[model samples]
Target: MAGDLGLWGIPVAIVGGAIRVSTPFLFVSLGEVLTERSGRINLGLEGTLVFGAMAGYGTAVLTGSAWAGVLVAALAGVVFGLVHGIICSLPKVNDIAVGIAMMLLGSGLAFYFGKPFIQPTAPDLPAIALGGWSDLPQVQAALNVNVLFLIGLALALVMAWMFRSTKVGLTLRVVGDSTDAARAMGLRPAVIRTLATAAGGAFAGVGGAYLSLYYPGSWNEAISSGQGLMAVALVIFARWNPVACFWAALLFGGAGALGPALQSVGVTKGYYLFYAAPYVLTLGVLIATSSTTRALSGAPGELSITK
Candidate 1:
């Protein structure tokens, strides 16, 4: 297939890669949306993500079930999120600083504990063959979508709807907008934030599972490549909208896939530059969306970044 298409393969490969690459972003950004919507930011998700990858990979290697690995990873993420939320809820505690610490802690833990499993093979998630109608190998390969990506897509839609129509969503929004108001309404802002953060961690853990058990299909110290951190910017760019986050993730995924896609066609002169496309896009989106005079429209009112 690589030899079949000379120039046309780039776009095709990118589209396919976007679907594969976007799963992690989709899950992480969605999780961040939940956390940020509850008036908290979790920087430690990088650690949570890395740890999840290690846990999931290790679990799969031991259990021989990819699904089990995902479940365990989500549970691990919950623990991470719970710790971050609980610590940040204390008076005078800084969410950003704690988040940074969490990132380091998670990465350190993953590296230390993951050493043994680095060389072990784990069960990988199955893909849905959506391109059976196509004869071209490239098309077939590109269309072989993973179940996690589809689930993420559905989850995004469900979350968007949930935010609009559910009492749970209304409560989260109220808390995110104003803790004083939430307290007046007899809501426990701290408890809500902690739970939301934990739930977000579960989503992130699943994202990590996707990376290790499916797409890249391996456990490594550098598996994440900072996608966990980039998700924060992705959420901001989406204006905190779940559906928008889905699209934004795909855009990022496409940018990420560009370098490798180009290389597949023998365009390797600027390969590293191509790999930097996602970072460049992140910068561009942040700059284009930022304003010194006014808070970002649609941002949660109590979000620390806006304040």
Candidate 2:
């Protein structure tokens, strides 16, 4: 597959595709990490992701600013997050079940509201060309990075630092690790979990924005392609570390590019198999990392999957 890129062209296309596809993964995985760390799991982010894509595309089409659309998308996600947070906080409620319900609700609402936007052309986020010195057009295109990708990188770094250094991060960690402990310390576990879920939703919403306003930039029903759901696996694989999430996203992104990269290199047979690369990778990671005796070392205590 590397040979198909024609010397410098090979790595360029794959790298470009990886960066393009990884943007959504980066944002969604980070968001999921935040929510899980707060002792909650939200499966409904898939719905939020789809809805955000619709909302962002529709807003950008109407308002003529992709950034405005992104803002709207984030707000929509916040609403979804708040709903999940509030519902899950009630006694005897199952967080996983609530997440499933929210997922359906978000997707349904987006489909209903997004019908008219299917064919519209919305403003896209701007790109920064970092490969200007390269004489190869392919290299330039591959290096033409999205602003959101850079932002995701910065966010990963910031999140890593915040989790280690900030009071708020410590509090969130405390709430996630032990609800009773949080209560003993006079902290409201429900409130903290609720807020964390909301923030997670916001991040996922931005991920959705990147989908509609960046790579595969368009409005449609089939836009998500499971990136939202895949993010859950990503968070787990990253061991709840933000920096690790970024690297994991890139790895997944590269896998996702395999089919295209292979085709670009003149390997036309079995192209569809390459499309399964990311999901296959996810499954492999799950199996390789799975355990029956105890939860992963860094898992938040209240997270349902670990239990």
CA lDDT of each prediction against the hidden true structure? 0.93, 0.91
Please, what are the lDDT tens digits per residue for candidate 2 over residues 1-307? 3454575554676798899999999999999999999999999999999999999999999999999999999999999999999999999999989999998998899899999999889988999999899776777778899999999999999999999999989998999999999999999999999999999999999999999898799988888888888899899899999999999999999999878887776766897798999999888887877999867879999888878
lDDT of each residue in 1-307, candidate 1, tens digit only: 6447878898889999999999999999999999999999888888999999999999999999999999999999999999999999999999999999999998999999999999989989999999999888998998999999999999999999999999999999999999999999999999999999999999999999999999899998889989899999999999999999999999999999998888887875977688999999888988987889988989888888987
Off by over 4 Å in 2: 1-8
Count backbone clashes in candidate 2: 2
Q: Model 2: how far is 262 from its true place, Å?
A: 1.3
Candidate number with greatest lDDT = 1
- Least well predicted 10-residue stretch by lDDT in candidate 1: 1-10
Global Cα RMSD, each model: 0.9, 1.6
